[model samples]
Target chain A: MKLGDPRKAYRIAQGAKVRLNEDDAADMSLCPEGGKNSTQGLFDSLRDRIQTLQKVLYAENKRRVLVIIQAMDTGGKDGCVKHVFSRVDPQGVNVKAFKKPTEDELAHDFLWRVHPHVPGNGEIVIFNRSHYEDIIAVRVKKLLPESVWKKRYQHVLDFERMLAEEGTTIVKLFLHISKDEQKRRLEKRLENPAKHWKFHVDDLADRKRWHDFTGAYEDLIERTSTDYAPWFVIPADRKWYRNLCVAKLFADTLEDLELNFPERDFDPSSIRIDD
Target chain B: MKLGDPRKAYRIAQGAKVRLNEDDAADMSLCPEGGKNSTQGLFDSLRDRIQTLQKVLYAENKRRVLVIIQAMDTGGKDGCVKHVFSRVDPQGVNVKAFKKPTEDELAHDFLWRVHPHVPGNGEIVIFNRSHYEDIIAVRVKKLLPESVWKKRYQHVLDFERMLAEEGTTIVKLFLHISKDEQKRRLEKRLENPAKHWKFHVDDLADRKRWHDFTGAYEDLIERTSTDYAPWFVIPADRKWYRNLCVAKLFADTLEDLELNFPERDFDPSSIRIDD
Candidate 1:
């Protein structure tokens, strides 16, 4: 399957598959034809192209693009944004990383805090662990009742549909890594002094419920993927391949829009300098 | 007087000053030597130096810095922040621009919305048109009754003293521009096509009541300029000079604290990689 169209290949076909990454990690490879070294160079070139396209995108100022990245712990979401989107002009792009909600955020509906940070026309925004967490985390941990959590799937669909109809292109990616890979990353974090701040004891408790999390992920993917805004499950054990695939998808989606510089209606030749 | 101590240079002595810039602009100059070209270079170097101090401040994690800049329309408050603080690490600095209150914010006390954004330790926060607006704008425009606005002066003094005692360094600047200079700026906005969006018809009405604004500004600066957070009147007719002056004040204040790099407990030789 073409790597650009990950939906057909990675979309959860079974509503009742009831597992996250149940297939072997070896089976989900989506790297284009190249050695690891060559693909790394290609990723750099794609990032440069994305930066150039972003200037035109800002000038055109017609549509907004929102990229939602959801991943398990130690799943390289920060690494993907830093490596891929850092080259773009900061004025044109905004990155909102949703941590724990605050008192005001809890006072309103789940979408209250997320709504204020949505991208405007001619803007590119990335949500690191976005509204999906409102559903996935609470569901798996049993933080909310089954009746409350189950109804959120339709709310998610309607929100995306409204945004899509109002000229937003939403690309949601679920970073899929093997359970063994997460264990290795967690151990590495504990061993490395520099990464110790990132390690939490509660994370070990969350790790214990790996199966429940997998079931929640499979259910969300089956229910929420739509034509207006589809979900793609990207193999994320290898950082280089994950960044390369996200950047490729971003570039392709923006290029399809055919953005152009805004029209300037003045005669520059007639203006004199040094007045 | 030393340029580093703008308090002596511009602080109002009595409950009133004859004018915002009563002396010659040449006398009010804070830029050191080499004319305008070199002052611009000095601003850049100070910005770089401020960036260095911010790193230590973040590591120290003991004190917070709050910068409050209040000015009339087209009074160079935005320009000062862009030129002075933009180079600081985005993680350490936040700029909050408060406009007309939202319905929810209005439902609460005036200080409710403003109190939440105060910086924590190891952070710098800038308020562009802050709570001081509660007194100046409302009093001049008669948005609130005389009895209600009169009590705000003491309230501001107490609020600022509490913050100062709790370990926040407050720097307040009133960007003082002449009414004539403001007229020229407003006219320039009309003549320049790119700046038309910033020009508003209501601004002309504000210009009509420049005297009332001046009276309100004089009163607030007198009532609220305690030793804890004294206000400086910056001569902002020249953008370059204004930026240089503000950056200088910031550098001198932070330097007086004598921040130190945090001690490293783990020896470099003890921690080995690639196990």
Candidate 2:
């Protein structure tokens, strides 16, 4: 569970079984006890780098980045987003939270509801939950037949590959948290006076079928983790470690692109005022 | 000119001549000399009111507000927007700036480029420059014949009426600035090293056609300022006064709605958590 080489270590192996229960929930070596100060120092440096990279991406207006985050209940997706992307200008980033599909959305093809939310040139788009739900949710709940739902994995791969060919950098993250920790978090949501509004009876029903959902995620991570669009399974019981891992991945992805300040279109010396 | 009774004072007269040069550019009587302090006090108060009202609007999720601001070059449209809307939540408000229409946009009816940007339920959308530009820009530059452009005033009125009937409160403001003031601002944009990038060569050509453009705006303000959606001819010579006046209009408009918190769908006294 050491996050030594996140790109290689944490990325889900192509053909290996993703046993969600087997993974360590809290890796203390990655995040030492009482380590908020040291973790925040690394986070600040990484966050500042993302802010600068985002500006260059905006100015270049050539490449697009889409970050898709999927998580179990109370798995800290929001916290990871806030800490990692807080420094980037809101104008440059568009966050779309995919809720239950509307009646109109249901009428269209599944990707139809998701396609329009994709990032445009020089933009960064974060999908809080995304098209992957078509496979996992439907499969877990038997919303669609096995024949229909199984084909979506290939469709998802093709759609993402087309986007890559057209200049979109896709990064998908499946935040990994233990089931026992999820119960703790969900119980906290009900116990905290301020968090009563966040709880739903349906979450309890989903938690009851936790093993089924894990099996669905297991297949999802194995089948859809393409070379062009890899899925990173981050250790998420520790919020600080999750933030650092996500931020570092983003910084590395951006830096690897070799972004440079765009060449000026006009000569600065020629801007003479007649007045 | 005093800015008292802004809803009554600044709302353009239905049949009055909107002679740009003849209108008061410096409404200093409303703001005393060296009185930025007092003007800011009024602005701060109004801005805070807008912030509160906007949250109520979001909570109620019923009505929508669309603020259309049209101004000539260096006419303080951006300044007016920033000062008036500085305190509102970025999520609750949307700002859309219409630049030169692309070829795809020009292929459709003029309103085609605008209709998609309209406010949705419980939202406030500000159009920095809007479909009114179809009437003003093309009419001034003779991009289209009079036969084509003349028909659009009725089209504009009809569009605004439909929006009004559909629970959207539309406030269109014509930021009124004198030609002399525009020249001074444009000169500043060219002379200031930091602002050199904002200066464009086409702006000089547009400045030369100031009189022709005013005539176009004159007809636009007269024909389209209807009861359903009135145009406010804000005196833009003084930036702080313009901000205060616009903020007051928005605050008054929201206050008139008598917005209340939406009735809760669930009881807070429900069964306690087992945890």
Candidate 3:
């Protein structure tokens, strides 16, 4: 039950997926409808801890954190980034959302564009979607030969190793949503007029290739979960649980870094006595 | 007294310089240290309102906001951004801090580097220091020809006019602190063993040129205060008042935008009965 030592813990979490049950699901649903009163106590308590750790971890320990999130559509990547990071000290955090590569990015190697945006010392950087996209997109569309796509796994591990050597701690999360849950969510979007804006034919296209995408993800989790940068497969069927796990992981990492607040010095006796 | 209007009120506030009396200063000092209690009430009432308004403003009214901040070294620009924006919905807001130009940025016109970061429709962008740096740095170090730097005022005015025509609302703040206060803060930093790393020799060089910098700031504020993007001179000697004024301006602006949450199609009765 203890998620100890990043690499070993990651493997156990991944393998323990088959053992996940209703209790975990119930715990995730701790967040209630209003999203205000129901979860306020948990988030508020954690928020204070996060603030204190952030100040110390950033200004003193100066550890750099890299968060990698890969998920199926409507799996709540945006929501996770926003809500979990709601209490972060922004000065030491940078969130980068990578979409389709621009022409300039195309000019360089895949890792080149990503290198510059990596968190500096005592900083936290979140990649909404990252280099893993290269594997997913290429695998789904057959954009590359099998040999070519397979080679990228080693390249990624090596890239992450470089980052670890440079003092970057990486947390990669794969939001695992069931096919049936996805279908229900998609139908809800289609049934509503206002929500129709979010639905697209391409979503259905991706769903049709669900098996291939799952295989790609399975391979991804197996191949790239290294000692330096490990992956967590979080069940994202319920959003409340997703937020809790993500928040816990972030706080735990800062605790691992042993954050301390910067000390202040002032002469208390310098003030004049009252007449 | 009304600092809310975009035109006439700006002119009036610009004409009058108000100083806080000792009693007023004493009363305002009671505002929370570190911005925790100072703006608590304001945040509680306006948090939900701002959230609902953000989406509507993004979809319907679509106004762009450009916030320009001017301050001395360690005047809390970073702290203000971190605390004041801690509650905002990020989909509509962006923060840009200007540092020394990179090689590519130096090759182009200085404004060229800044023009790209300006707010687009439905965006609220914060500029930590802005194109006015050309004037400030140039005036102090004589980095550019007087003719070139002087001409930038007219250029900046024209650029802002273009943004206003395109629906960008501008807010500029100059965080003003006395030399005595700066000396006290800097001396405290030097005396603090924990803060030794934060103190840089370069900062002392800038502090020695305090008179020159103040003169430059006076001229820049006098000339650049206009109907559009008028500057609010805030007392930086007290951090709480600065946060209060900034929060007030933000709340008032969103209210003016009249943002409302979109209606969801989910059946209210279905949930009510089940619950």
Supply the TM-score for candidate 3. Answer: 0.77
Query: For residues B93-124, could you state the per-residue lDDT of candidate 1 as single tens digits?
Result: 66777778888987887788899888888878
Candidate 1 yields a Cα-based lDDT of: 0.76
Docking class of 3: incorrect
lDDT per residue as tens, model 2, B1-275: 23466778778766666666645766645555456665666777788899788877876779999999998988887667656775565456666778898999999999998998798877888998999888889988889999998999989889989999999999999888887777778777656554554567788788878789888888899888878789988888878778878888899999998987666444445633332
Span of 10 residues, lowest total lDDT, candidate 2 chain A? A266-275
Per-residue lDDT of B1-275 in model 3, one digit per residue for the tens?
A: 12232222222254344442223221243233445454567655555555565656655435778888878876768767776776655545667778777889878887998887787766678888989898898778888889888888778888888887888888787777766666676676676665554655567678778778877877777777777768766666766555655666666776776654344435422421100
C-alpha RMSD between model 3 and the true structure: 6.5
Q: Please provide TM-scores, in order, for all candidate models, with all chains considered together.
A: 0.67, 0.77, 0.77
How close is each model in CA RMSD to the real structure?
7.1, 5.2, 6.5
DockQ of 3: 0.20
Ranking by lDDT: 2, 1, 3
By lDDT, who's the top model here?
A: 2
The pairs that clash in candidate 1 are: none
lDDT over C-alpha atoms for residue B175 of model 2 = 87
**Taking candidate 1, what TM-score does its chain B reach relative to the real chain B?**
0.92
lDDT by residue (tens digit), candidate 3, A1-275: 12223223323342233333323322343343554346556655666777677777666745688989898877778778778776665555667777778888877777777887788777778888998988887788897687877888988989999899988898898777777667777777666555554555667678878777877887788778766787877767777667766776677777887766555333433422121
